[model samples]
Target: MKKIIIIIITLVLFGSCKKDEPAPIVVPIITSINPIQGNPDTEIAINGSGFSTVVSENIVKFNGVVAKVSSATSSTLIAKVPISSGSGLVEVSTSKGSANGPSFTYIPDIFVGGIESNGSKFVGKYWKNGVAVNVTNGTNNVTIYSIAVSGNDVYLAGYETVGSVKVAKYWKNGIENILSDQSKDAFCYSIAIDGTDVYVAGSEFNGNQYVAKYWKNGISVSLTNGQVSAEAHGIAISDGNVYVTGQEALPAGPLVAKYWKNGIATSLTDGKYDASAWSIVVSGNDIYISGYEDNGVNYARYWKNGLTNALSYNGNNIVDQIDQIVVSGSDVYVAGRQSKTALYWKNGIAVPLTNGSNLSFAHSIFLYGSDIFVAGNEFNGTAKVGKYWKNGSAVNLTNGFFDCSPWGIIVR
Candidate 1:
């Protein structure tokens, strides 16, 4: 009888202990994320369960960098992408546990190349998404004429002063690659890249006169015979053929607009008047050149497959020049200045980008999707400012206190 009573008491004690214990906490489960790719500060939505109702208690991260969480609930939350965050998986944490969502990708940035004056020296720089990166060491005067980006590599073509001589060079991600030997004065005005081969077009002083030349993988090829003054201002590579455009000064005549195909010169003008080509582009088998001809007055013009088409009226007392040309699909775009006003021509139709009140010039043009981007400088009363226009809206890249000029732009 005594043993039976003790056994019942022990069973009753065990039942009471089990009833008083608490349940286990459930871990947070991240299910999905919207808009898998974006730039910094982009808001993203996360859906899951077992999250904290309080925003501060929930933690979010992008590629190991902490993201700012604006709001949070048990099943949903909103967070902003962090700056300098690389592409990686996003994770969310709570008091229960942590869970990872889908991977997020960063957008390819925009780059603009130009010259920045620092006190007494001019430095070569390229702005990546509005952040400035110096290409030169700031010891000598340098100018960056053109910029191109392929994959993750950035290439800039320009010239830097070496002692008393100007040396043509190209910079690959801030590392200088010399194209000229400094034996003579040289200038690199344009650059084009094809796989592993790098081409730069410019002019070199050869004893008597400036000779138009280009360098392929650091090997020099003369486009001119070194007999008269000539210059190669633009370069493009398509279908394994190299094309360059510039002006060739005849013995007693005017500078003629000319283009070279694989080192063979073809005249675009009759050389009866002064003319020069500043930019060139090749699409399919058609070649487009942007330039100006002095027919009593300067007039902006472009040639399509060697057929000249004027962008502005001839002898209209409007000084104009086309500095860059780009083609997208069947549309042709040219950037330049018309009577001190920035403008771009699309299929020979002029679209004014700036008012005629202030002096502005567009030096480079790029197309991304349906958006057009132009880079150049604008005079803000006291100083020239570096800026770029996206779909005709201007965005200043530098403060107006300093003199800066954006000569090239590339959006990826």
Candidate 2:
């Protein structure tokens, strides 16, 4: 009986020992760090998981300077930002592994930047001299598409929900202007500033058809009142001439790429397939627009002085779009995403900017002096963290917390 009882005790002890065996240790993921850092002693925000166990051996550095950790949560560690001794990416190290964050340069306050759309509604924030400005105006019911800055006041164009209807409206300094107060569908997608007057291009529904329209200083002008279902998605003004680009759906079931120079609509496509323009830029009256055309396969393309150029034409690709365009000196820069990769083109030369094959996209581009900045997202199958690319290297901006995306870029 004693031997049998000892055998049972040993069996129970063995079962408890197996349960007590430690599971494999999971290393924390350092998904991102701030790319454009703040001043010295500024708190560095780190995003990822498994950071709570980092105590003594773990260290974070910014451009070779050791960073002092302030506080650490489960997935984030805040550290005092170190002074940059050189230009390089910020790196972090633990006893288990290492990761790199995007790079940053010391500068003044983050400036008055533009706004971008994240799937549904447009959201973002900016600062001047380190003071943050409200971008959303505390509303999630509206979709803001375009923004322009002129001195103190900021102008925005988008659709605001009126009951169940989404009506197009413009905001001057965050005050909503009912320019074309229609109870039907309408949206403003582009805005440009010339001196004190603001110019906006958008689409409005007139009875049964949608027409491309422009608004100047709260007054509306329809470019194609009700001739066809034409929508304007981009707008720019140079030397008092307004340029707008979009697509006009023809009766033959093909949407041709169209642009209006001072209310004169010009078709840029040969009507072979469907085409749409996303962005427009003007360099000395030579209009350039970036978009995509369906030549049996969707290709990233743009029109320069009535000339068509394609950026990608290889894959069984069906959709590629350019979201923004900027001209720096003699160079023309276009930014958008292709095959879920953050893509930028310099004078029509394609460049892919991303840290890895993880899902990344470029939504906006900025030119500060000679440096180029691209803002977008880096996705890891599930979650998408905001990413910023300077030159060609990408920097993780969100640090992998609740997910962040950069829609606009500007330097002050």
Candidate 3:
């Protein structure tokens, strides 16, 4: 009887211990889902609470597609969108119940044609069969002055003034990146891309004069501090050296056109009125810089090897700027505006894109293989329309509502 009573007591104690065990943890709740449907390569952001120690494995997928978690916060997760083509619906599962987001459309692959220049705006568009297609509009709010292309990525340089302050900005793959934090003023006039690094050249104001400044990988480099009040207008990368061109202050209170190889200043012109370098080209060991000289009149010009190339003089008046340069086999091509008309030169032969009455100006040039593309604006009596030319034939790309223009072009 005593042994039976002891065994029963032991069993009762074990059952009581089992009944007192701790309960399972309750999963945190997800509050909201935003941009539920996203295209491939797009980032999807998820918001919730109690995500303090969230891991990639914690991210569950009901659709079976692998989603890469890019970043995570205490209450949010940034994940790379999967190749969800058919139906854009995605269901996310976790230790808690599943949550679903709506379907989103995929962004189509764009074939880059090359960059083109309008006077103040640089426009990039896709071209097919010698015609412009899918031209980006609403570019007047921001000016695209110059462009550089590497692979399918395109970079732009320019400045936009919001009220009294000018801000230097650039765009990569069509996404805008502001380089300056100044509430005063800044401008990026030229852009160059070497491998994956992007560089820009321009000027930043320092009280009285504009200081020469450039950026490498979005980092600033001031070639001229505040001493001489220099300006950097063009930038190019050849071999391994970075070349920039513009004007420097002189003792006589005028600017002299100059270029720097890896920041080593080299004077290309010594004129007093206003000498500026707008574009640069490199061929083998030869470096060519183009702009205009304000002697008695504004003349389109360029220089090679510190010596003036005979082709520098294009016989234009009151207006001239070389916004871009490209080397074709053994020939060189330069594009800019000459006296309110779009102008291009190949091997020293000047070709006008429009009559002076059109008030058109080409700010950039692109040569893909044997084809050439130009971007700018077309004046139609009352307003200017954004336009791109493939093979010298003009095609309007935007309506005249906001004076849009193509500033950059690339062919991929």
Give Cα-based local distance difference scores for all models. 0.89, 0.71, 0.67
The TM-score obtained by model 3 is 0.64
Best by lDDT: 1
Candidate 1: tens digits of C-alpha lDDT, residues 1-412: 9999999999999999999898878788888888889877789988888889999999999999899999888999899888657789999888888998889986646899999888778899999999999989789999889998875688999999978899999999999999888898999999999999999999999989999999999999999998989999999999999999999998996999999999999999988888999899899989999988888754778899999888762235355667899998889899988777888889977787888788998999998767799999899997788999999999999898878989999976
Stretches of candidate 3 off by over 4 Å are 1-141, 310-319
**lDDT tens digits by residue: candidate 2, 138-181:** 35556656656664566667766666676887777767777667
- Sorted on TM-score, highest at the top, how do the candidates line up? 1, 2, 3
Which candidate comes out best when scored by TM-score?
1
TM-score of each: 0.76, 0.66, 0.64
lDDT, residue 255, model 3: 77
For candidate 1, the TM-score is 0.76
lDDT of candidate 3 over 220-306, digit per residue (tens): 888876777788888888888898988888867777889988888888777557677778887888888887777765466678777
* Model 2 CA lDDT for position 125: 47
